[model samples]
Target: MVTVAVTAVAAALVMTGCSGGPSSPATDNVAGTPSSGASSTSKSTPTPTPAVVDVTPADGATGVKPTAPVVVKVSSGSLSEVSVKDAQGKAVEGKLANGTWTSKARLAPSTAYTVSVTAAGSDGTPATTTSRFTTLKPAVTATYGILYAGQTVGVGMPASIQFDSAVTTPELRAQVEKLVTVTTSPKTEGHWGWLDNRQLMWRPKDYWQPGTKVTVNAPLTGVQTGDGKWIANDDSASFTVGSSMISTVDIKNHVMTVTRGGQVLRTIPISAGRPGPETETRSGTKVIIRKEGTVIMDSSTIGIKKGEPGYYKIKTQSAMRVTWTGEYLHSAPWSVGSQGSSNVSHGCVNMAPENAAWMYANSKAGDVVKFTGSSRVFQPSEGIGVWQYSYANWVKQSALA
Candidate 1:
């Protein structure tokens, strides 16, 4: 009876422990199986972001200066390509380096431009961006002209560029100088100088070599001359340097000597300016600007009116202009007897009709005419008086100096 009672109590304890209740393996100690209450979740990696592109002169921006550079920047990847197009669908030149792109060519004023950029992400995914902007319209569009264009000139003739508006400051003038380019066939050495605010001229250290071919390019359409002023037109010219034709006029002795390539061509009787301030030919180097066939000489153009002391209007033949102030080497028939003797005319080199015709027929524009022995000096600001200044002094007039 005692053994049966003990076995019954042990059976009751085993049944209680095996019951699917609070003590059934504690719900986490299951064999060969993971528990739902414990953390056994697998982790997954996050996805990477794509590349980003940024453009300068932001999209739809207006009134942008042409000088402002177009820039493109990329992040999280490498730049694939960049394209900038104008309204005409012409591509703007640009360069890319170190993941950045910048415009290499100048933009036009009052024009619309479109920029398209494409880049690749680290995951080899390509992304694109675009921008549109318009350049500012200049208030005053300046104009310019290239001198001695399409002509054969003398060795002493300098390449001249004249602007309608004045370039006020030296800094502005330097900017204008940067737009000019000159080239020679034989590769001559030369430099540019400003005789005044409106005139920019290029001359060699010495006279140009005969038979040299010169070409000039001035892409000044986008150049700024002053505040609110921008050049709207580009200019270019090609000129040839002809044979060496230099003439010397001796006022004291009243004679004119012509030479061609260091050899004496002819010695002609000539009468130069008489003694006086208002009626004396300027003494210095002069470049023949143009040949006028039959010009009416009016003293009023030189500030001498009808009733003035030296006022006279006459028609001269075979006239070659040497100065802006009413001076020329022309045919003066009335003063033929005074030729090579006494200087008795206005500020002009009077020669016989035959002599004047011969000189005009043989000479071209840019021929050198040098006059000596006079009280009045030729100013650099006068007609193509570039030879008056030494090469060193002429260089000092440059904006860069």
Candidate 2:
């Protein structure tokens, strides 16, 4: 039995050596250590960079001011191109640097603007983005109609500005007042007056020198009016002063004298307003606003209705408008004989057709028209009557004063 047991133990040992007994579960490499075996599936694909872009105002925004700041940027990519345009398709000037874009181009008021951009990912994948917005159009806005280029005007042409909305606050008015400046080649002293909240006019203390160059700069973008309105954009004009053409109309003598550079050009017989409230011509320093070959004269337009005394409508030629209250230097053929002898008809400087034509052709807008010898005083609201106020008095009209 001992011999048999020994033989069996020897046999078991040989069998154990021939085949491994129980196999333990295959062990994984320690965490973060390299693995000997490779991945079973095909080599895994690498992750790609994300494509992204952004623009200010998002898209489809409204009530944007022309001066609103703009920005464009991209992430995980580089910006390739960007463009901005207006409703008229004019390009807004911009600059791109340091992976960003910016612009200072002035925009049209109450206009729509668009922006388009392109970008490239790290892997060269192209991506595109776009945005559109509209500029603010205030229900009330300011209008600048006095200053314009190329027209030779008189020294008395005030920078007449009117607003659809009233500006009553002093600070608000000051904000607008500073944005407007008049620079002359010779450099002249001037002052601005608020003719009420809605109108502001600038004029020199003395008449402008003949041949002076005046530049009117009105940068109103983002400027706030006193009453919930802001300036939409900017406007500028340059004008050259022509010869000094001034006319002195004497209501007593019933005569008109035109002068240039202190020399008399023409002295003609003229018929002024008859003695009355509605018929009296304003007697103060005034500027010739504009001229017309023929303007239909209407007394009712001046609040002198039909059946009222001295109410007659007549068509006249060679008309030069001097005041807003229906006063003009026009040709009156029917009153030619009485022109130099008497004050008759309505509130107009009536002269012979020949004289009227000569004056109209020679005179430029801004010419000085001084009406004296009458009790009538020009109101600041009546046409370009800025000369009605003295320099000191005019200074008092400014909010900044």
Which has the greatest TM-score? 1
Rate residue 1 of model 1 by lDDT: 4
Going through the candidates in the order shown, the clash numbers are: 0, 0
TM-score of each model, paired residue for residue: 0.85, 0.69
Give the TM-score (vs. native) of candidate 1: 0.85
Error of 1 at 5 (Å): 83
Q: Tens digit of lDDT per residue, candidate 2, span 275-322?
A: 888788879998898887799998788777899876778999999999
Worst 10 residues of 2 by lDDT: 1-10
| Candidate 2: residue 182 Cα off by (Å) | 2.0
lDDT at 274, model 1: 86
lDDT of 1 by residue, 285-349 (tens): 99898898899988888788998787889999999998877689999999999999989878889
